[model samples]
Target: MVQEIRWGIVGLGSIAHTFAKDLALVTGGTLTAVASRSLEKAKAFAGEYGVAHTFDTYDALFESKEVDVVYIATPHTSHEALSIRAMENGKHVLCEKPMGVNPDQVARMIAVAEKNKVFLMEALWSRFNPSIRKAKQLVESGEIGSVGFVHADFAFYALNRDPDNRLLNPDLAGGSLLDIGIYPIFLSYLLLGMPKNIQASSHLYKTGVEMQTSMIFDYEGAQAILYSGLNSKSEMKAEISGSEGSIFLSPRWHEAQGYSIEKEGELVDYNLPTKGKGYTYEIEEVHSCLASGKVQSSMWSHRNSVDLARLLYEVRQKSNIIFPFEQQKEGV
Candidate 1:
């Protein structure tokens, strides 16, 4: 039997709760510890997850011998610092997506992970979803021939959210582009490699954060049209068109539970169920990497995170959307 991989989670946010629940369903791993800024919140999460250890301070959790790996679920701006600290403390890290706000920060985090010889990966859970995996397989198998065009969107209305909420706060790197927009961007990158050209634009909220953003990625013989926003709801569907047929990842494609293939006047639907809110898949990937003595997931490597960050930076530049913290850091 494989030895259990001990897991620690920093930041007891809503996503962390879902992750903890999914961790319970994964084999070869257990949620050993959790931390939050509030001791009460840490204790509550620990109790709910049956975790053995809890800490009010993130550093305390990083220092705990009980945790072999730490999942950093903090906001976008905090990922770099927290991940670096975790690696420096000799803990492997699986940070939530948009690994860093910019390429430089991602490079630093990757450097620290390499220096520490600890595993590090971005938890872009969509990459591991069963439906998405199957879609990749079908595409690779030529069931869709050569992909030529892709269209995807992720959006939701958040106008009523308080101005200080992380989704709207510039200091926290709040913006549709970094938050939900990333999903569509990631899908494009996953299907089509780095684009030859990227054209993007955005509508900024009064707080100076992006409310809606659209992007067009030009490849050698293909193009990807993508959009994300916090101004209105969208169908949240994605389509990959090829010479032979097309594949559709169902609504909310990021966490897609099913997909369809269309060809020759026929449509085939596939239902790929997920375990425990769909986070177990990524957790299992981490366990596999650690068990194999690998420092990064081949599927979602440090380089991929860096490349994604760079792409996001380019998109922001084209859109003229800048995070307030970035401005402050640069003394702009």
Candidate 2:
């Protein structure tokens, strides 16, 4: 068994930095290498993290014999290509959420992983969060008494950011749907499973990027109301209601530190704080899977990622959401 798991991080962006910081907190993983299109960026990040190697290109990083796995933190559009290349080089991958731009892209990534016989998992950290996991247990134990409805929204005001930034740049697959919207959808799927039907609406900015989206997922006997936005800020809370009581997740619920359950007019809150931005939990999961020779995480498997991508693409279809590149490719 490979006792010490070596990690290489591609993309020296904010999320990558956060993940790298948490990787240090993991027991068996070491940040041995870093990579980016810019060597200076990679070197700077490596220096801060006490990393030993830096690669100017992802190909160099994936070809590294030292790195057992890699974390892909680049833009949404690059996830498929980067992950395919990494897996082809025999490096396990822990990709950032949404997995890909759509279900098709995600499927292709999975096929490559299978062909390479390497572990691959979407870094949907919320699925492994302590508080969220507890909530799942509570709900499954009938603490919530058969879920009837779910409500979650993740939003923030980012209109002032540069138009070219990822949040607003259509070229980078920018949109509220693929970014923050996936969280609410994931919560719904986690608790309620796939919906029987979906109703959605979206608002777009002048640059053709989706600014906000509203979704209604209909299950057999339950429903989920979800939203995501960048034009304005929201409470970022989440709620799940059942016949006997209601469960509430704190603001910024995706990374919620605590949650409450209300039964018969009495509300009880529970605190389950995360360790190191909550990415540590998923990092540990990847380590466990790799150590055991597993090709996917049981918690957030490839199937879950594909389903989430399908939900996203479905919402886009119903809401008439289309990106510039997609339109061009389709010759619209």
Candidate 3:
């Protein structure tokens, strides 16, 4: 029998709480420890999750001999550093999406992971979503007959948030593109691959952060119209159209609970809801890869993460949406 994997969660925030709760439903995996900058916060999260270890410093958690993997759930700017440190400590890492602020940091993280021979995966939970999987299967099976266009958007109003909040803080890599824009980017990559040409526009807040971003991805035979925002709420549905038919994802498509395919004007519905915060699927994949001694995932490889980051970098460059950190980091 394969042994279970033990997890050490870095950054004890609300999202980490949700992740801890979901870990309860995963077999062969357990939340063994939690770390935060504050002892109080770490102890609180550990107590709530029934975790045995709680540390005030990330270094302690990363260096812990008990932890087999570390889930880097910190803010966007911190992801690269934390993942690299964990991997350097001989622990696998599942970092939250947009993996790094830019492609360069992502490249460095991948290199370190490869050098250390440790498993590393971006926490793009949407790829493993059942509805998304089903949609991909239909597309690959020729049910859609050569996709010509893909449209997806993820948006919600966040203008009321405080300037100090990560959503509005430029120093923290705060912006619609990194925060919510990644979902649309991921969908586009999944369907259209990397676009040969890219055009983008953004509406920046007075704080110099993007409030909304719209991107056009031009491929060999198809195009994708993607948008993400903190200015308005969208239907949040996704569509992939081809010569023969199209597939429509249910509302909140990124976390797809169901999807429908239309062919010759006939629509067929497929519903598959997930449990908890929808992280169990990726958790299972982590366990599977670990058991196989794989250093990266086939579904969300390090290269894929780097590609997505590079695309975002290009989009930001075109839209004049550079973050403050870009100036601090040379050659960003």
Candidate 4:
């Protein structure tokens, strides 16, 4: 019999709600506890998930022995501190994407994870996504011989969103680059590895946060054209083209349910539906790693996260995007 891995979630935001719902669809793991700054919010979330514990403060939950692992689902600005505290408290951590506001923060989080000797992973659900995985496998197997180009984009209109919203608020490190841009960037890195040279440009919102970013990642003989924006809706399609064929992840490709392969002038499609809201796959990955006594997932290692952070930070630097918290580090 497998022992159930106890799961706790911090931050009861919209994404957290989605994650909690998907957690129900996973097996060998149970939502043991939930924490929020507001006791009412914690209790409400706990009631919905049948979580055994609820804490008004994150520190309270971190202190509780009931939680074996904590999922940090808060905004990008809070990920570093929350995750470090959880690891320091002897709890494993699965933090949401982008992991931190900058490479420095991410390094701090990783250092704490290493020092604590606890499991830590950036919850990049797409890395564990079935369709994305198949596409990567096909590329690796030479189905897409000698990759030459990769293009992906994720965008949706949020310019109308109030300035106070995290999507536009510089205080929360809000922007298209860190929020949606990471998806396309992740795809580029997954298939193409690091770029030798890069070119990037970003359009800023009224709030001083970037609303749009376009990037060109240059590899040895390959290039990836990526774009993300909050000013308009994008096609949300992603394609990886090589000398022989191309792999097309369908619309809204980040969480694509299917993918197509075009080879020898023929296109073949494959359906690989996710179990629930896509978070279930990542939840299962966490379960597997914990069961195996692994500190990081092979699918998305800590090095991968660090590399991704560096890429993000570099892009921000090239595009002149800086969060309020990082301005001091920038000597501004």
Clashing pairs in 4: none
- lDDT by residue for model 3 (35-100), tens: 999999998888888999999999999999889999999999899989999999999999988789
Candidate 1 shows a clash count of: 0
lDDT values, one for every candidate: 0.92, 0.92, 0.91, 0.92
Model 3 score (lDDT): 0.91
Tens-digit lDDT track of model 1 for 233-288: 99988999999999999988889989999999799998988887999999999999
lDDT of 2 by residue, 1-332 (tens): 55699999998899998998888888998999999999999988999999999999999999999899999999999999999999999999999987899888999999999999999999899999888888888899998798999999999998899999999999999978888999999999999999999999999987789999999999999999999999998998899999999999998899999999999999998888889899999999999998888999999999999999999999999988877777887895
Residues 1-332, model 4: lDDT tens digits: 87788889999999999998998898898889999999998998888878889999999899998889999999998999999989999999999998987888888998999899999999999998999999999999998899999999999999988899998999999999889999999999999899998899998988999999999999999999999999999999999999999999999899999999998989999899989889999999999999899999999999999999999999999987877778776685
Q: Cα-based RMSD of the predictions, in order?
A: 1.0, 1.1, 1.2, 1.1
Question: Which run of 10 residues does model 3 get worst, by summed lDDT?
Answer: 323-332
Candidate 4 local accuracy as lDDT?
0.92
**Clash count, candidate 4:** 0
Give the count of colliding residue pairs in each prediction: 0, 0, 0, 0
In model 4, the Cα lDDT at residue 230 comes to: 98
Kindly report the root-mean-square deviation of model 3 from the true structure over all alpha carbons: 1.2
Worst 10 residues of 4 by lDDT: 323-332
